[model samples]
Target chain A: MGKIRTRLGDGSFIELLEEEIYEDLVDGTQDAAQKGRIPPLSEDELRYLLDLYKSKARVVGVDEGHECCLSYDNMTSKIERAHISVSKFQQLQLFERALGADTLELAHIDYSYKQVKHVVIYDKPNMEQAVLLTIPPMLYGAMPNLGLYTYPDGPCPNPGDLLPQGKFDEAKEAYAQAIELAIKDMIFVGSELYEAGADGINFDTTGAAGDAEFYAALKAAETLKAKYPKMGIEMGMAGEFILGMHGEIEYEGVRLAGLYPHDQVKLAQKAGVTIFGPVVNTGTNESLPWNLARSVTFTKACSEASEIPLHANLGMGVGGVPLNIMPPLDALSRASKAHVELCRLDGL
Target chain B: MHAAHSIASGMGGMRTTGDLVARLQLNKGMRIEQAKQYVADKLKVPVTDLADSVTMGEMREDLNIGVVNEAPGVAKGIDAKFRIAELLDLDINCVDMFKDRVKP
Candidate 1:
C-alpha cells in the first residue's frame, strides 16, 4: 500500500493509516459534535490532532447534499424541510475543514495513512445551475448565456422561453465556465491539496443534472476528463425513479414490471462515460423492510445494461433527523449481508 | 522588528503588537519573548524564520474553528465506504479509486 506522512500534534510525522478504527472515532466525533461535546481545538491544536488522527482511519467520502444544497429550489422549497444550503465559497471553506480533519484518531489506536487521497465532485444533474451562487463576478456579467432555468429569487422560465432550447453554443459555453469556476473555487481555497500529492479527481455526474442540463454537464465532464486525463473522470448516471414491481413495462407484447434504468445506461456510455450502470433508487414509498425483492430486480436491470462495476447506494431515507442519518439497524444489517453476497457489486 | 512580529500574528489575527501581547498574556500568561519562541516552535523554525507563502488550506487550518467535526456526511460515509471496500476487495485507501482506476 502507498503511504502518506501526516504531521502529528507534536510535529512528528506518522504514516497515515486508512480505515479500521477510523469508523468508531468519527462516529464518536459526530455524536459528540451533535451533543455539544467536542470543544473547538485551536487551529494548531486542530491541525496536530487531525494529522495524528489521519494517520489511522478508514472511512467513506461524506456528502451532505449535492445540488440539493446549492440550488435555488433547495433554498426556497426545501428550507422548511431543514435541507442544507451553502454557497461555493462556503463549500471551499468546508473542503478546508474536511482536509484538516482527514479521519484523525481521537482515542488510542494504530492506523497508517495511505498516499492516495480521493477527491470526488458531484454536480447535481445539471450543475450548470451552480452559477446562481453569484460567484466569480465574471459569471454575473455572462448571466443570460448560461441557460439556467432560473436564478435565486428570479423569475422561472417557461420551457418555451428557455433560449435556444438545448443549443450548444450559449449553454455549452456557460457550462464550461461554470465548471471552470468550480475548479477555480476549489483552487482558491485549497491549492495545497493538489500540490500535497496526486489526488484522483473523480468528476462524477448525477441524475440531478437531469435531461435538461445533463448534456451540458457531461460535455463539461468530457472536457475535464480530456484536460486532466490522470484524474480519470468517472460517470455516475443517476437512474430515473422507477417504483420497481409497481411500475410497468411491456416487451414482446407481454407486460412486465420491475426496477431499472432501462436504456439510459447506453446514453451514458455513448457520451464517453467509462463507468456504466445507472444508480438505482429504492422507490417512492420508503417503508420498513425496504422492498428487498425490488432492489434485486433493480440491480438485475443495471447488470443487464452494462458489465461495468456498480456502487450500491445503501441508504434510502433516515427519517426525521432533518439531515438523513442512521439507517434502521435491521435494514442496515440486511444491507450489509446483501453487499457481501452480491459479488457483482464492486462498491456502495 | 522581526523579533516583535515573532510574538505576533501567529496567534492568528489581531496583527498589532499590543493585541498579541494581551492575547498571549490572557491565554498562555506569557511575555512577548515567550510567545515569540512559541511561534518559532510551532513553525519548527528559529525566532527569525521570517515569512513565506502559505497555502489556502494552511491559512484556514491556522484560523480558529468552534468545533472540528468532519464534514456533513463524512462519518457515516466512511463507515459505508469501508464496508463497500471490504466486500468489493477494493483499496480502502483511496475513495476515488475503485475497479483498478474507475472511481465509483
Candidate 2:
C-alpha cells in the first residue's frame, strides 16, 4: 500500500497515507489542486491525519486523561495538562513543596525585587528544591460554585461560558484570601489570572470598547486589594490583546492602541495594574520573530516605560530551549531558570 | 561573695528568658515554666521556677555541667526533651532526673 503524505505547518512532510487509503485520496488530489496544492484530503483522510497527530504529535508518555502530564524532551522534563480538579489550596501546598524539593534555585517567585525563598515540603526530610512553579489561572477558575455574569446576557456558569458574572466576585475573594496568606508567608510575588478572550463568550470588547472588560477587571482588583493591602497583582493578558490592540476596529467602545510594549505598560498602569503578560505557550509550533527574546524585551521595555513590573508567559519548548514546553519536569525547570535570570536582568 | 561567685558561675552566658520562651513554643506541649526550668537546670543553679527570669549567675554555674553557651543547642535539647516527655507521658522535670541518674 502507498503511504499517505501529510505536510505540517513547518512545511515538513510526513508519509501517513497508506495504499489502503488510496481510494480515499482519489478526490483529495483534485481538491488540493483546485486549492493550488498537490491534492485535497477527503474527510476520511483528514480524520486519519488528525488521529495520527493526536497519537504521535503529543509529548510522548504523558497521559492526557490524567490531571497533569509529566513529559521529557531532549533538554529536560516538564509537567503540563489541563482540567485539573485539585483545589487551589491543595495545589498551592503541592506547588510550594515541589519547588523546594526540586532543589533548583534558578527559579523564584517574583514580587517586584523581592525573591522569596519557597519552602520545600514534598519529600519532607529528603525534600528537593523547585526552581519554578507554573500555576495556571485555572486554579482561580475552579473555585466551588463561583459564576461569572456576562453582559447582553445575565450570569454564566463554568469557564467556557461567554459572559460570566458571579465568578469574578468569587475570584476576587479567593485572590484576596490567597494574597493575605501569601503575604504572611512572605510568598506573595505575582499571579497568572485568566483573562476573557475576544470571542463572543463575554463581551466583544476585543473590537469595541474592550476597556470595559479591563474596567471590570479593575473592579475585581480593587476588591482584592481591599482585603490584602500589601498584595501585588499581575494580570496575564491573552495574545489576542496584542493583536486586537494593534488592528483597526469599527466599534466605538473598542480603541486601537499601538503594539509597542510601552503602550501595554501604559495601559496596565492606567488600569492600576502592577504586572502584565501575554500568552506564550499555545501549542503553536512556529517560533515568534524574536522568539521569547521579543517578549522579554517587550516586558522590560514596558516595565521601564511605566515603571511597572512585567512578566512574559513564554510558550513551552521553543527552538531547543524549553521556553514554554510542558509535561517534562526538566524542561519546566530549565525554562523557569531562564525566566528567573531574565527577571533578574530586567531588575524585576 | 562565695554565693555570688557560685551563682555567677552557674549563670555563665545564659540566653535571655524570652529566647527560651520562643524555643519552647516549637516544642509541642512545653509550658513557659518548663522552658524556664530547662534553662535554669542547664545553668546548674537552684531552679527558681520563675517564668519571667532565670538569673545569669545561676546559668553560669550550670554551664559547668555540659551546658555550653549555645542557644540553638539548648533549644534543640529542650525540644527533644519535650517530645520524649509527650511520648512517654512523663513529667518534663522527671526526665531530667532520669537523665542525671542514667548517665552513671
Candidate 3:
C-alpha cells in the first residue's frame, strides 16, 4: 500500500496509509460539529479533502473561479520584523505591487486602537501613501485592546485580579468601563484614519479581551459605518469561540460571549462589517487532515450564515494550518484550497 | 554570551533577541560573535544578558524591546522594534521613513 503524505498539527511531516485517511477526516469533522453544535461534513466535502491528500501533487490550490484574495491583519508590523531595512511605505508598496495583496492595512506596532489613537497623527503620512500609492484598498487596523484599561495601565482594576478576590461586580464594572473607553478610542481613531484617506478600518483580533471587547468592536463598527457609509470594516476574530470573560455582555440582543464563528459572523454583519474574518483554531495534537476537516466544517457554516464576504483566517495555528511560526506550505496550501473549495470563502 | 544565546535559540527556532541578532547578522553581514557583541553594546547590557531570559525580560520591560508576558501599556510585537531601532541606532527602513514623515 502506498503511504499517503500528510502533516501533524505542528506542521511536522508524516505519512499515513490510505485506509487511515478516512478515519482521520471523519474524526475531525465530527469533533468540530459536536463542539460547535453544527453539522458534520457530508460525504462530498470529505471526498475533496481525501483527493487533495491522495493526489500526487506536492501542493494544492483553488480552481479558477474558486480563488480568493487575502487581507493581512498586521501589515506594517510584520514587515519590520522580517525585513532588515524596509520603510513602512516601501513595505506596503511591496505588498501592493510586488506581493499583490488585495487589501493593505496601516497599523501601529502596539496593534491596538487605543495605542494607535495616540500615534495616528504620526501615521497620517503613511495612511495617505497607503491610499494614494497602492492600487488595492487600504485599511487602518488595530485591536480593541480593552486590557489597557486595567490597573498599572489605566484607571480600571484588572478583572483577572478581581474575580479571584470575590469581587464579581467590580470585575464586571471594570470590563464595562473598559468597553466605553475602547469604543470612544476606536471611533476617534477610526474616524481620523478614515479621514486621512484609508478605504476602511479593520478591528483586527476582535473579542480577544472577551465579550466586552467583542461588544466594543461591534458598537464601534456600527458607529463608524453610520458616519462613513462608504468605509469598509473587516473584523478578524482572535479565536473560534468568544471567551466569556464578561459572560453577560450582549450586542444587538445576542449574547457576545461563548459565540462560535457561525453566530459571531451574524453580529458582525449587523454591525455593517464589509468582510467577516472568522477563525477556527487548529488543534496541535491532531493530524492535518483532522484539523483541516474541522476548520473547513466550521468555516463552511460561517460562510453560509454570513451575508457579508467571508475571509476566513488561514494563518498559522488557526484555520487548520499548523502552529509553526512558518506553517509548512503543503498543509497551508491544502487547507486554503479546501476552504476555498468547500467553504466557498471570499478571501483568506 | 555564546553558550547562553545558542541554548535559548535551541528552545525555539527564533525568539525576540535571537530574531534581532540573526537580522543583524544577515543584514549587516557580521559574524555571529560580532552580531552578538553589537546587540549587547546597543542594548547597554552585559553580553551574557542577551540570552538570560530573566535579565532580558527586565531589560525588555524597561526598554520596550519586547516582552514575553505582554501586559497593558507596554510595547509589544512590532512596537518594541521601533524602540529597538532608535536605541540600537540601526537603519530600520520603515522606522526611518516614519521619522521622516511624522507631521511636525
* Arranged by TM-score, best first: 3, 1, 2
Candidate 2 residue A60 Cα shift, in angstroms, is 22
| Cα error of candidate 3 at position B53, Å | 49
Question: Tens-digit lDDT track for model 2 on A38-120?
Answer: 22333563343233322332222111111110101110111212336553333333332232110011111121111222322
* Candidate 1 DockQ vs. native: 0.02
Q: How does model 2 score on DockQ? A: 0.01
- The residue-level lDDT of candidate 1 at B87 comes to 31
Q: DockQ numbers for every candidate?
A: 0.02, 0.01, 0.01
Deviation in angstroms for A249 in model 2? 11
* Model 3 lDDT at residue A299: 96
Q: Model 2 over residues B1-104: C-alpha lDDT tens digits?
A: 11111111111112222223222322211322344456456434434432212454243224321122334444333333344344333333323433554695
lDDT of 3 by residue, A173-231 (tens): 99988888999999999998887767678898888888999999999999998997767
What is the TM-score, restricted to chain A, for candidate 2? 0.38
- Provide TM-scores for the models: 0.34, 0.33, 0.76
Compute the lDDT of residue A340 as modeled in candidate 1: 21
